[model samples]
Target: MVHYLYLHGFASSPQSAKAQDLGDRFSRLNLSLNIPDLNQGDFSHLTLTRQIQQVSTLFPPGEAVRLIGSSFGGLTSAWLGEKYPQVERLVLLAPAFGFLEHWLPQIGEVQLRQWQQENYQAVYHYGEKRSLPLHYGFISDVRQYCELQLTRPVPTLILHGIEDRVIPIQASRDYQRDRPWVQLVELDSDHSLGNVLPEIGLAIQSFFSLK
Candidate 1:
């Protein structure tokens, strides 16, 4: 049996709109989509390496797996596909390609400096709807995983919003370039892609050849 999983974006959770929407779709199809909380209930200690390792444990041995990852989780899924041959396919939604490049600036130099000095900074968690302290190690740990090095040829499909100012559609465009195995679909929406979720669902269904 093929294992299906959904990995939510940074500061998001299993109850995210996109995750719930896709879960509902899978439910209607009599299929199950496993969504694990990458935060592990400790947002302050979260790291890219931790998230990747956490998801890796869910992969059943020798089982074909398909992943639907959003934003940061999309980045995680890409790396997983690279390292594990069992990850047969990937559907990335506004995947955070240049995560550090795009995210560090938004945090600002002063904030980053303070975070480095203090080892943690208050980050607004959209999932928890509250501010949580995030450690500097998050940025440092991610330095080792270069998305540019992800040249693994897995059957990948990326759904990115044309108006996404967060990660931007250009990130997906760059990822799809020179990677004949990867396909990108631009949606008319912003970073949240809330407006185009139904369209996204249909595209995912088509990508996986789902009925």
Candidate 2:
């Protein structure tokens, strides 16, 4: 049986509308879907790693798994795919390839170092009753990890919007440049492709069918 794992964007929860839509689609297709809640008070690299490890442990061995990740989760999916060959297909939506390069310049090294030393956690409101913390370690860890690892080119589907202000669509284009197994789909919407849900769903269905 094919199992689907949906990872929400940074600061977003599994309860997000996109996650629910994917869950519903998986149910209709009779595929198992896991949407683990990554919210933890620790709000550090250790916490996020533990959450991902715990979620990964729940799946029985020898089962085919497919991953769909959005934004930071897309980066996480890339890491997971590199670490685990069992991931049959990876779908990334508006992924940020070089977050450190993009953010560190604006915040500066001194402030980032200060933030890391102080270990401050600033809560930002996401959906209702849901919040995520701004953590220096999280940003630093993701940057370090991506830089250290080689790009793992598993069968990948990249969906991005031309008007994405958060993460530029060109990032996805650049990521797909050298990767032979990547498929790029550009839409006219913004970072939030809520309006193109049906088209996204169709693309996902078609990709899985090809496999």
Candidate 3:
């Protein structure tokens, strides 16, 4: 039995619409899907290392898992696929490669300096509709994992939107450029990919060889 896991994006949760959609799709096929809360109750101490550790604890000692992740979670999935051969297959949605490079500039130097000084920055939590304090360690921790180049051929697939302004579609293009094994599916949608869930589901079904 394959252990299917869905890792949500930044500031998102297990209750995300995409997660639910996948959960429902898998459920109809009698497959169990796990969507772990990456935040782990402490948004202030959030880091990629911490999220990876949490995910690591989910599976048994020698078991493999099938991963589907979006944006920040996709970045995490890429790291996992590189480090752990146990990740038998991977699917990334609008992966945030070079995220730090894009993110820091958006926040600007002054804001970054202030965040470093204060140790935390207030960011909007979409689900809760309130600003939460995310620690600078979150940004600092990504530096260690950012340079990861995924060369492993773990049956990978990437679904990116053409009009995605959030992470930029070029990021996916650049990521898939040299890796011929990685299938890049471009959809006429936005960053959320909300309009193409059915297409996304079909792609996943085909990748997993599901009926």
**Cα lDDT tens digits for candidate 1, 74-160:** 999999999999999999999999999998999899888989999989999999999999989998999988777898899999989
Best by TM-score: 1
What Cα-based lDDT does every candidate model obtain?
0.92, 0.75, 0.87
Q: Which ten residues in a row have the lowest lDDT in candidate 2?
A: 39-48
Looking at model 2, the pairs that clash are none
- lDDT tens per residue, model 2, 1-211: 7678888876778888888888888788877678876654444343335545755775569887788988877877777777777787999988767766664676677877777887755545464354445666666556456433636668999999999877889888888888888899999888888888888888988988932
If the candidates were sorted by their TM-score against the true structure, best first, what order would they fall in? 1, 3, 2
Candidate 3 regions exceeding 4 Å error are none
Candidate 2: stretches off by over 4 Å = 41-48, 105-113, 128-133
Window of ten residues with lowest summed lDDT in model 3: 145-154
Candidate 3 lDDT at 17 equals: 84
**Evaluation by lDDT, superior candidate among 1 and 3:** 1
lDDT of 1: 0.92
**Ordered list by lDDT, greatest first:** 1, 3, 2
